[model samples]
Target: MLASVTGKGVCLCTILWILDTKGVFSLKNVTLSIEPSVVQYRNTSKLRCTYDLEGDALYTVKWYRGSLEFYRYTPSEKERDKRKQAFPFKGVTIDVDRSDSTQVTLNDIDFVVSGEFCCEVTTEDSHIHALNNCKSMVVVQLPEHPPEISVRGEPFDYGDILRANCSSYRSRPPADLTLILNGITVNQTEPLALRKLRPTDYSDLQLELKLSDLHFQEGQLNLQCVAQVSSVYHETVGLELQSVRHPVPEKVSAPNTASAASTASSQTIPLRLFCFTMLCFNAESVIKILIKTIPASCVTYYTVVATPVCDYTDIRINSLDKFYALIVVINLINIKMPHNDNPK
Candidate 1:
């Protein structure tokens, strides 16, 4: 019952004997291939069914979503009619016009459409009947929104500790999460990270980066968190340090030398400028000048006085041993300097 073919006939007694005894002539090979086995919701997918028939006796091809048959093609009829085709199962949609005898196309697929699919072929013949089936798996990944980045620190600055967290919208398959700082990958080993699975079939990923004694480059550094559902699909967020209080660099000199006094004198101008920059401005104010000096050894001492449309007066005190306050009712003046200065 083999079909007519254009092949050489090797009519050997041993081959014929083995084929008859092992029932090899009745076997057929069927294979089904699905494109983009993993996909996001609302995406298109294609399925192809192929088989090698030993004999062509009105073969029928069928496609199934799980165990439910959704599409079929009969070779006996030249044109497939739409009126007699079977309806697709609930939550599944297929393009009947585009699908052919060996192919199935699903459009606008969603999370509910993910499942096992089967392709089957059967031939009609009394003595030489043959049937074959093949199965494949498909998964629908959910799309996630842009990731969110948050920082847990106050007055961000160098030589400080901080933590950053990046989180994405709920998604299936637990979006692949990564943290990159200055274009370098940060992993769980470097920072204590935590990952969790939600009860809603979603994923939650988090990373905790402990940056102790933050570096100078880190001030201008960029931190980014990226989450991906697939190779071509993902979201990212970036972070930067904010302005904060920073310790000033100290300039010291050798003890009992002329250079020591000169160095301290040159450094006082810039120190006053630094203090002026840190002051907070307000509208309603009275004149307030407070000067406190603690000279450990040999160091230069300077004083700045500010008057606001009022009479000028010079005030002096002997020692800053105890608390003292000098209040003026109309002007405000402030001088900035280091808390303690020692030469040598």
Candidate 2:
């Protein structure tokens, strides 16, 4: 009879195992969702738990912050008031009216609330089945203002060294800092500097960028500093640097003496003097006298006199005395004109 009872018990256990393998009265796809996994202090956050109970009824759903239980939902409770209950836990504020079997709402969260959140679900069956899921949440105190960027070695120039520092004030998790030059990220080889302030848990972060042989585009360089705290807060500040250099002087050249003499000699006498000479002498006789008295190099003045008057005039010589007088005047004027001493 004992062997027969043992065989029956083994058969019952086998049947339960087969039922579980077929997903009958079992939990599947248990998930925990936390909105704003990284949350700012004094803000609200939501936590949701979801599960599929195949061919089973939910007995209880419980919420825990770390290992401490703060909320429970029992749909099978006979008293309607007892169906949802909240227990006290430090740093956990539950809005009971807005919470249900699948989700819980947290209000006015602070840094103390940062920890692992867990959800547990149990099935109502003679053979009880339970499932739980946990996820991490962080509550941070954000910096009050954006990051500040300070640059040293102003008036940058090519082949010069440039140094800059980016700083972010007190924050729960110190902000990450990056330096960008003209849309390209500049890697920081040095370790970041961290400082902790008194009377608070918040800390400060600072990064430095020291670049040599600085290059600029279009006579200017653009530098930016970005600070970020998780996914909740981000800020960027930028500055432009202009290159400076000294002015250059221009060269001056001396005047050419030969060119000045040539210009002065080419100056022509007045037309009235030509008209007066033409009235005193015939064109052919004046040409003969000019060729004999003046050098061949000075024939340009003869051409100037003959061109306008002799080409169109039929005037007859009235006096030889006036002709001789005009020749004397021409010789005296030619002597007064400037000439180059050194001929090339």
- The reply for model 1, stretches above 4 Å from the true place, is 1-29, 53-58, 82-84, 123-144, 154-159, 187-204, 212-220, 230-232, 240-344
- Stretches of model 2 off by over 4 angstroms after superposition: 1-18, 21-25, 187-214, 245-344
Look at candidate 2 and tell me the lDDT of residue 5.
100
> Best candidate, lDDT-wise?
2
Tens-digit lDDT track of model 1 for 1-344:
24323232444656687755554455467788878767656777788887766555545778888778888877777556742254566665688877877788887876676778888877665434445565555454654467777767744565556576766666665566777766777642122124445422433445555554443353455678887764555677887655344433467855886556556654332112111211232222222222222233212333332422222234232332344332222232232344456634
TM-score, every prediction: 0.52, 0.61
Score candidate 2 by lDDT.
Answer: 0.70
Q: Report model 2's TM-score to 2 decimal places.
A: 0.61
Backbone collision count in every prediction? 3, 0
Expressed as tens digits, the lDDT of each residue in 249-283 for candidate 2 is 35678888867865667642222122235434456
Q: Per-residue error at 17 for model 2, in Å?
A: 6.1
